[model samples]
Target: MGQALALREDFDGSDLRRLARGSRDADQTRRLLALAVIYAGGSRAEAARTGGVGRQIVRDWVMRFNAEGPEGLITRKAPGSPSKLNDVQRAALVQVVERGPNPKVDGVVRWRLLDLAAWVWDRFGISLSEATLSRELKALGFSKLSARPRHYAQDADAIDAFKKTSRPAWRMSARRSRPAPR
Candidate 1:
């Protein structure tokens, strides 16, 4: 039920126990609750009420149980595509980064993700996508480092003098402007 009450109905057959053994998903738990309520002589409405799902869903599971029993409660997995990189490739990539600076191609010092991906494919012969490679690096406590422009006042005295003398007097500008012809 939506509200918690301390009513203990006569539940049987360890359906909930076995469902708990399978997976901790909400669907499996709901199915088990439905079976427990209805199979133990509780009404379809009462089953839905106790299980906190709609009456029709409870009735459906009851019908499914009647047809296939406990095995009927098994939930199907969500369909999807498979992953790209395997454990071995991930390990090799991580090792290369942790070992530090990459070899010079044309004299650029450090390695980027594409460079790492290329190196990984060349050395270990395992092609890892840049996205997956980034995830692996983050999981291993590595973060991207970048540089910011620094304002280094090398000669503060010279800079201060330049700023002070940089402006022309208002009187000088006024003197430089020729009056409009009458």
Candidate 2:
């Protein structure tokens, strides 16, 4: 039993209908049409029916429209969860990755996702899973790359010396022919 919200007087039913016609967003257009019904002296129930939404939703649309005009009716993507790393932490992470790990100090020849996660936990006190760390790395423009494994005792020169230099030439034998009309 609260007082009914008033629609903005600047735009009338025809203006809303025209805006709806030009709008690219289907949801915005639908909302505009519904509000247009209200502007045309139609009941909230009628507007709701036109919009294919409930009366409460129509009321919300009216409030949004009143505050922000036609632009407010457009649906927007929801803001997702905030990043775990702040700017300073992210910069530090980037620097660590670029500088590479020291085997003597960090106990690793190359950085793995597990090692990175542990490093983050130790440095930032933030526990991140391997997958989450990988995702973060990827978002920060890092790709997973590993050098091909080679045996410690393998000799490159010996391998080159055993390799075939050229293809072996084949010798063809002369073929005997039969009489054509026999």
Candidate 3:
């Protein structure tokens, strides 16, 4: 024999339907909601069982509509605004700071943050603060190496002699791949 019908809790489904009907969410949500009202309980109470949404979701929609009105139904707040520097600009900045500004140009071995910032401003026309420039270079895959002093002869022949005999650790022949064919 069929059991007696389950008495629905005092919840009135019309309240939720009325609120959902006037909401401003994209038409799709409104349509789904009409169906949910039936599935939830107003008509059949099947929507709540299958949609995984609590039957109280209908009440939530009504309450939300009352508090914020319509547009509150849609979700928002995605992330925004990425870095201003593009890949090539970032790469050039990193290369200039980490490896460019050779001794011939800067008159010294290492790069300085202030100098790098100036160089970046000149090249990219975007003035980068010193701390920002440092952080950017690091972000672009470069790291700082501490500076050390070096003394070298200006004369090519003197430099050659120094390389060959004075600085035994720096043998030029070791750097040469092989003797050219005769």
For every model in order, what is the number of clashing pairs? 0, 0, 3
Each candidate: RMSD to true structure?
A: 13.3, 7.1, 16.8
TM-score ranking, best first: 2, 1, 3
lDDT of each: 0.67, 0.93, 0.59
Residues 1-182, candidate 2: write the lDDT tens digits. Answer: 88779999999999999999999999999999999999999999999999999999999999999999999999999998777888898889999999999999999988999999999999999988898888888999999999887889999999999999887798555555544576
Best lDDT among the predictions, by candidate number: 2
Q: Where does the lowest 10-residue lDDT sum fall in candidate 1?
A: 2-11
lDDT of 3 by residue, 73-143 (tens): 56557676566578899877766665656788776556788877777677888877877877777776667
Per-residue lDDT for 60 in model 2?
98
TM-score, cand. 1: 0.41
Worst 10 residues of 3 by lDDT: 2-11
| Off by more than 4 A, model 2 | 145-182
Q: Candidate 2, which ten residues in sequence have the lowest lDDT sum?
A: 171-180
Tell me each candidate's TM-score. Answer: 0.41, 0.72, 0.37
